[model samples]
Target chain A: MTGLKLFSRRILPQLVTLAVVVGLISIMFPGFFEISIANGRLYGSPIDILNRGAPVALLAIGMTLVIATGGIDLSVGAVMAICGAMAAWGITEGYGLGLTLLMALAAGLACGLWNGLLVAVLGIQPIVATLILMVAGRGIAQLITEGAILTFNHEGLIFFGSGSLFTIPTPIIIAIVTGALVTLIVRRSALGMLIEAIGINLRASTLAGVNTRVLLIAVYMASGLCAALAGVIAAADIRGADANNAGLWLELDAILAVVIGGTSLLGGRFSLIASLIGALIIQAVNTGILLSGFPPEFNLIIKAGIILIILVLQSPTIRTMVIFLSPAPVSQADTEKQAVNQ
Target chain B: MISKKALVGAGLLASMLMMSSSALAQTVGFSQIGSESGWRAAETTLTLQQAKERGIDLKFADAQQKQENQIKALRSFIAQGVDAILIAPVVATGWDSVLEEAKEAEIPVILLDRMVDSSDDLYLTAVGSDLVHEGSVAGQWLVDELGGKDCNVVELQGTTGSSPAIDRKNGFEQAIEGHANIKLIRSQTGDFTRTKGKEVMESFLKAEDGGKNICALYAHNDDMAVGAIQAIKEAGLKPGEDILVVSIDAVPDIFQAMAAGEANATVELTPNMAGPAFDALAAYMKDGTMPPKFIQTESKLYTQADDPQAVYEQKKDLGY
Candidate 1:
């Protein structure tokens, strides 16, 4: 009974939003849900959403934890650029595939460490702290590629971009595995509650013997690691590292996914699966717009309208109003649920 | 060994004397927008090569995409009393005061690649390719290739609301207008990047009956076309054969794709804007020949017959 209640209260909204988006796209294009085996892989609009949504989903995984601690990551996109650049440079310079990935991962970890130090040690605001890398990370990436889209023909590195495993796309595989690992590390330990405690009152949590600084740094490192993986996948997908464009402006999408997942920006409880679904919802809308045959000018306006509706529906007052407008018996039980929720 | 050294020293001295005697080599200062794109970098390289070929002394300044830095560079060029000034203004406005200063110094300024909103008399001439014309060239080639066969085309447009996206889309549509056989079935913004191009094309393929309905693919730029070509291949379709590919911008990678027969056509957005600018400047400096206010560069088209392999080899190291 508790599990059922938790699913209905915590994850139901995001799951319903994703279903509606997919259903809407199917209505717009009759062939939206048609999946078939092509080139030994599941090929369809849904797969494309998961495949294309991989980077944002992975970022959302790290972003959920950070937001759960009352922090934000503006540098993940830039860090992705840096890591992609590092991977490309390593591959071209003959460092091989394994070393190249390690190099990219190390670059991401270093960027995260720098960001963590600024926010945790120096006591800078999260936005301002990450903004430094947000501005400079691309410049550093450009330097690595020497102001060009660094292309490589290494088969090993390219496998990470678009390769499949057991008929599943590599990017989707990476996203799911990383998301699950992060979920386990956070939920299966005291880290989850500690993060929430810090968000509610940082000084109080610190006084209560939470190693706030180390935990903060670890959270940032995880975000950086996720970004690095995203960067590798982006570069691998295109078979090159485009320093100017790799994961450009995707941090906002990650934040939006977390928000749409019903995670509060003020930081508290977070659900990894909900954020992942939020990312899929965004991708479904993007793919739907492409298949709608509408003019390009209508793209952003339609997306904005849909997102506005979703947020309005996610509002607590709106939910309560919706329940009140529903059957009378349901409203009485919903008020009790709301009471428990508070 | 000493005699050999003396001979080499004498040869070097003779070359130095000859170089100094050619003091008539005009000194021109070029104020360039920063290396923002691969095309811009190629343009800079070609500009330096053009100056060298003409025995002209060129002073170059990169403004790093800032208008203030450009103004400073222009002031310094004027102070150095250069023979002429060439500027690729990053923006179209805020050049009136600087142009007035250059005009007062009696130094003729030529605009390259991009234009300024300043008065016509402020600069001698502006040299650039017609972006719309480039798009029309790509479209015209497709029309000529298909010969009125009924076809469904998919378009991968550039970044939304960008000038190139707008102008290129207009030009292509205009060229294909009144053609009953060629219909553009679907079009979407690819954000003018390879990754977005591939992703959008994937969605396009899924929407268009596994790409069987798409007879040809038109991209606003070569990068997108290159990416779309890959997507078509991944969909188990030969890009050049099944869906004819036409795009603008003759970047080196696109040439390589053409060499592999994966891409069909590209219209060149030549990076040699400085070549024509130099010619006009030379004429203006000599015998009071004032070039026209706007000099448009050629938008040459390339096909499979154009020896794309040789072209690729030539352009591979131009900093592209």
Candidate 2:
């Protein structure tokens, strides 16, 4: 009963939403669920979701933390471009895999530190603080590449993008390991509660000796780190770094995934796993549109329509209405139980 | 007869005017629409090279994609009394006033690579490649390669509803309208990016019997083609062998892919718009002759046979 309660409370809604989206896709293309191994790697629509969703899923993990701290990192997409360019530049210049990865990480951390300084130290609004980097970050990336697509043929670094581990793609493996590690770091220690506490009431949390300022900066740094990893994967995936288009407008997708996962932008409680699932849902819809053979013009419209339906279903009143409208007649006791579950 | 001598006299006057114009190097001003992409950068580099070769004094302005900056540059050129002015307008509208200012100063204006909404009389001539023609070139290449053989093609389009995306799709469809043997089995937008192109192609390979059913791929741009080639390679299928890859915008990377025989062909969206614009301005300066209102640059197609390595070396330095 405890396990059932935990499942219902934590992951059920996101799983249901994912299942519904996958069902809709399979309806459009009957072979959507078929998975086959080719070239010693898993190949199918499902694998595509997890593999393609890796970058955003990683971003969502970091975004969930920042959003929990009542902040947003709009510069993540640009940070991705910067880090990807750095990696591409490094790899092409024969910096080797380890040094390239380290350089990219440092770039990401530096961008995050800058953002944290502006927001936490300077007392600027999170949106305005990150917007500075969001605007100038791609320009910085372009400058690094001298305004071109920096291509690389480094096999060792490219493995992080397309290589697989025992039939699973490398991106999927990286995302899962990162997500699990982040989840353990937060959940295993008092870090999760401190973040939630800060989100709930910053001044009070500070008075309670939560070290709000340092924590806030650390949260933003974590987000930056995630964006850096995502950037490397994206660059490696294409075997080149496209400074202009690498992570264009991807921050919005990460935010949308967080919101769709039922994490409130208003701050407070959050779920890392739920947001990861949200990323997969978004990718599933994208993959579905591709497999559906729809005209390109309808891609955004269809995606928007489905997202609207999902959002509407997520509303508290709509969710309650949906439960009430079900075949099981709800008594007063059941209503109270449902309310308690919510 | 008197009429024959009169014609000779008129010819002498024209020749003298041409000689006088050629004796002095013309000073012209160029306002480019920023280095927004590698292609635009290449256009800028080539424009500078073309000016050097013709011994024209070119005052270049980087407008950075702002109409106001372009307007300021035009006004400055007019003040300096340039021989002619060339502009690649960032946006289509809001050029009437500055163009009129140039007209009042008697400075002939030539538009490059992009069109303005102002009247044709406001500028000397507009030089650009037809985007629709670019698509048709790629499609026509596939049709010729297939040679009436039954084949299936998948297309990776540009951003949804974008002008290039819509026109390129329509143009490809138009070129293959009567070809029953070639079918566009699947079509999707790659948003003119490599990541989306690769992702969409992976799905296409899976859906079409692990790519066994697909015979060719057409991308709206070389970046997408470069990406789709990688996808085809990862699927354990030889890209140029198993499936023909054709795309538009012959960017430098595409040439590298072509050299390696990963990509089959690419239609060049030539960066030489400035070459023709300069020629037209020079012609007008020499004889007061009015060139055509629209000058279409050639949409040259390059294949493996075209020595992709040499082309790559040539374009790599152009900042593309």
Candidate 3:
């Protein structure tokens, strides 16, 4: 009984909510369970959703960490663009794949360092600091590509986009692996505790010897690297480098995913697994809309509605109701009291 | 000494008259929609070059793809009292008021590359390609290739509510009206971005189960087509072979794709819309006689057999 209560307190509410939503969608779309898994590959339209969801999922994982630290990285999409342009340029210049990937990683790290320095060291607002990079990174990308699409003859990169590893899409595998790594870092490491502490109270954490500045910088750097990885995957998928549209509006999607996963925009709380599920939900909704023969314009309206619904459900009032209805009572009250105490 | 001073004063007066006459020669105020695309860039470059060659004092303002900025520049030009005005509108709507303002100032306005929505005839003439015809050309080519066989197609639309999107779709649909063989199975806006185009195409592929049953892909522009090709290839289908791809813009990448046999056909919406545009502007400057309400540029269909390599070589020379 105690174990069940603990489980309910920790994860049951989110799982139940997710189940209810998925059940409703499945009811509406009869073929939702008819996903074809041939030779270990999930065929049908869902694969596209999973594929398209990869980069956004990667970005949301990083954004979740940064938001948990009470910071925002607005330059993630631009970093993706810059990294893609650089990778494409390098490949076109006959650089080896390993070197090009390294260059992309280094560029992302440099951008993150610049943003981190402004926010953590210089005491600038996170939004303002990242916004500068958001604007300048795009300009840098354009400069790298000379405002043109850089086409390359790299077969290895193309394979990363289209080839399957043990019947799973490479991008999907990468996203899953990255998600696991991030979850481990956040759930098992001391850094995660420090981030959460700093997010909750920056001054208190500094006095507590948490090295808040270093944590802030580290979070942004991770976000940059995640965005760069996404860029490489995207470039590999397309077999071309398009600076203009490489990562356009990805930041918005990442923010939305994090928010939907019960991460507070104001920070101090986060869920890596929940964020992954949220990203999946968003991707599924997009795929559902497309498969249902609706016009693509309706996607914006539907996505906005989903975010609103999720946020409203996460509100304290609804959360209280959800807690009361979960068939267990004492632990729910304890968690509520603990939250109130915090 | 008195005679020398009198001569000097006369010479000074002559020089001032010459300056005034030169300044008044032909000041053409041009408010350009900033560099949004390669075509727009080429148009601007050609317009400036032509203006310089003709000794027309081109008072240029780049609106940077904003209607508000263009309107502000236009008002500034009006205040400066230039001889004539040229505008390349970013959109087809919301121009009646500003155009009326220009009209009230007695400056003739000429539209370039795109048209305005209002029927006010506020502008002298619009110099652009026949956008509807460009779409029709693509549709007709697809029809010929299909040879009266049933075919499923997916369309990659341009920006929603834009003139190109509306007109191109209309033209393509009109051409394919009686042809019961060709059907557009799925149509969605790619927002004219390569990424969005690929996203939409991925969905299309998934829904269609990565099959060659999808007859052809039609795009409003080459960038979207290129994106669709990527998605098609990713789905393990040969783009130009399994699914015939057609689009409007004959961009350099499109030619390269064609040369590589990854793209099948495209209608040339020449980026050099500037040549005819300047010719019309010069005629108007020479004599206040206005040209046609819409000056249509010529468009041609480019096919794989048309020697894309040669065309690529030629376009490189043309600074594409």
Cα shift from native, residue B87, model 3 (Å): 3.4
DockQ for each numbered candidate: 0.65, 0.64, 0.29
lDDT of 1 by residue, A111-196 (tens): 99999999899999999999999999999999999988898989888878777888888999999999999888888899989998
Q: Which of candidates 1 and 2 reaches a greater TM-score?
A: 1
lDDT of 2 by residue, A1-342 (tens): 997688578878889999999998888888887887878998888988999999999999999999998889999999999999999999899898999999999999999999998988898999999999999999999999999989998988899899888999999998999999999999999999899888889889999888888888999999999999999999999998999999899999999989988888977888999999999999999988888888778889999998998899889999788778888665767889989999
Query: For candidate 3, lDDT tens digit of each residue in A1-342?
Result: 996676456554456656665675567656555555543455556577778889999999889988887889999999999988889888888888889989988998888888889989999998999999888888898788776677776887765665678778888998999999887877777877888888899999999898888889988999999999888887777777777788888888888888777778888867777777777777777766665556766767876786677778778898788777888688868999999999
- Candidate 2 per-residue lDDT, tens place, B1-320, comes to 47645643553465345436754777778899889999999999999999989997677777777788788778877886778899999999999999999999999999998898889999999999899998898889989989999999999989887889988988899889899999999998898889889988998998898899999999999999888998998888999989999999999999999999999999999999989998888788889888999999999989999999999999899978
Interface quality of candidate 2 as DockQ: 0.64
Best of the candidates, DockQ:
1
Counting only residues 3 or more apart in sequence or on different chains, how many pairs clash (N, Cα, C under 3 Å) in candidate 3? 0
lDDT of 2 at B36: 92
C-alpha lDDT of candidate 1 relative to the true structure: 0.90
Note the Cα lDDT for every prediction shown.
Answer: 0.90, 0.90, 0.80
**Candidate 3 global TM-score:** 0.84
Task: Tell me how large the interface RMSD of candidate 1 is.
Answer: 1.0
CAPRI tier for the interface of model 3 = acceptable
Which candidate achieves the best TM-score against the true structure? 1
Q: Lowest-scoring 10 consecutive residues by lDDT in candidate 3 chain B?
A: B7-16
